[model samples]
Target: MEWSRRNIWCVILLTCLVFWVMLLVGLNAVA
Candidate 1:
């Protein structure tokens, strides 16, 4: 159970990182 919880957290963090990267790229493209 602990392992599963940790895995979920890692996935969430990775997704968030990807989202921020995409947002930055889009803003740069616009400017």
Candidate 2:
């Protein structure tokens, strides 16, 4: 159970990072 919780957090963090990177790239392209 503990391991599963940690794994979920890692996935969430990775997802957020990917989203942020994509957003920055999009904004830069627009400008």
Candidate 3:
């Protein structure tokens, strides 16, 4: 149970990072 919780958080963090990267890339392309 503990390990699963940690994994979930890791996945969430990674997803957020990826989303932020994509947003930056999109903004750069627009500019």
In order, candidate lDDTs are 1.00, 1.00, 1.00
Using all chains and alpha carbons, the TM-scores for the candidates as numbered come to: 0.93, 0.93, 0.95
lDDT of 1 by residue, 1-31 (tens): 9999999999999999999999999999999
Clashes of 3: 0
Clashing pairs in 2: none
Lowest lDDT sum, 10 consecutive residues, model 1, at 1-10
Clashing pairs in 3: none
Residue-level lDDT tens digits of model 2 in 1-31: 9999999999999999999999999999999
Question: Against the true structure, candidate 3 has what lDDT?
Answer: 1.00
